[model samples]
Target chain A: MASRMRIRAKAADGVTEVKALMSHPMETGQRKDAEGNPIPAHYITEVTALHNDKVVLQAYWGAAVSQNPFLHFRFKGGAEGDTVTIKWVDNKGESQSDDTKI
Target chain B: MNHHRRTFLKLGGAAFGAVATAALWPLRAIAAAVRPNAAFEATALDGAYKQLGGTPAESADIDLSTPDIAENGAVVPVSVTSKLPGTEAIYILIEKNPNPLAAGFMIPEGTEPFVSVRVKVAQTCNVIAVVKAGGKLYSAAKETKVTLGGCGG
Candidate 1:
């Protein structure tokens, strides 16, 4: 599958700030369809961020997160041209990863 | 001969069980470290805090920012930054949501104690940011009035 994340990492003053937007349904399982059928819960459960193959940040999310989630964070020791990767695994066990240069 | 065969079958079963556990140990550990499922399943603020294993004291050092009023409850912008030293984790909780715990971010060494995300609020409620610093829990809260509920159809 294609990358589901749009990521931007900028290095400035010895810190790399990373911002990512993930495309996800984030269904809370409480909403209903047109026929009033309940939607099953499907949301990203874990997100991991890596800087130059080293883990930097990890996030755990619930269905309360909005659809198409956005995350912003910063880490030190990352420089320009270093690799920053963002990966997420949902409750259904599906996973996606995308990387970019800082 | 029958007794010997039964003993052999029991040994084989035990060996298979050991192999399965060895194969799954790391995966289970990683899952537990990455996601605290009990905390996410909590339906109230106190329940969530209990699952997280601490009572958070209100702190001014944790800066929590949210809009005064959210026109759309489906997506309310929230951000938190902890000024306390040794800040390890940050948790976002919406008091009125069906489940109070919305998200948790682990801030490893060298990472800033700041996070930003958007969350669904069921109704007008208080958005709380709890920070774990130096093995203690600190939190700050802000109220956001939602014009529409986010969880209903």
Candidate 2:
């Protein structure tokens, strides 16, 4: 998807705090072209974050969502230096993934 | 001859018309530029709005501190403090962004509503701070300006 994504995480106070930013047009079909044509809806529909293979959080998004989504979430019991993986898939089946360790 | 005076008047009128058009150039350009669905964007907020379930926000009891104007859109400083009891969550939203949701925090009980951070705003937008406490939402907003183009993903 040629996505430009950045992830930052911190495991403190027994919580794995995660901040994620990803790139996607997230076009809602209701939008129009230069000629006033309806631009089809295209957006990342699902995103999941994992801490050492255990799913920490997952969400389902919709066209109402905006482009270049930015998300922040945290989980209990994650430790420093643990690997955190995040993945997202768009409505068109396009996908992107990345990982960062705290 | 009177015709010469009339001819001069016609030239003067043409020059005056040109100057008038030049003075109004910016307004004309803005009028032609897209005005964005300001109303729709104003009402449609971002983030998992339902996850932090609460009553629709009312503009009372939340002390939202921010600049009257944000000189930079890429990283505007934002802070939220509240008088609401047992404040549990705070969210930042940009009303003019394609998606109004900028950031959401699930502040654990006892976690303060005093949160500070930088948020990216693509254009001139309203920054909404929603504080959830005691199962209700109290909110406030400030208008921030993004002078440079930071809207790019």
What is the C-alpha DockQ of each candidate? 0.78, 0.04
Candidate 2 ranges with C-alpha deviation above 4 Å? A2-4, A12-17, A28-36, A53-67, A72-77, A89-97, B1-125, B146-153
User: B65 in model 1: Cα distance from truth in Å?
Assistant: 0.6
CAPRI class assigned to model 2: incorrect
| lDDT (Cα, tens digit) per residue for candidate 1, span B39-121 | 99999999999988788999999999999999889999999999999998999999989999999999989999999999999
Stretch of 10 with least lDDT, candidate 1 chain A:
A1-10
Model 2 scores a C-alpha lDDT of 0.65
Looking at model 2 chain B, report the run of 10 residues with the lowest lDDT sum. B32-41
State the weakest 10-residue window (summed lDDT) of model 2 chain A.
Answer: A57-66
**lDDT (0-100) at residue A84 of candidate 2?**
85
Q: What C-alpha lDDT do the candidate models reach, one value each?
A: 0.92, 0.65
> For residue A11, what is the lDDT in candidate 1?
95
Tell me, by DockQ, which candidate is best.
Answer: 1
For residues B16-118, write the lDDT of model 2, one tens digit per residue: 9999999899875443122222322343563334433443467678877666666666556676777788766566667766666555544553233565555
> Which regions of candidate 1 deviate over 4 angstroms?
A1-3, B1-32
Provide the lDDT at A2 for model 2.
76
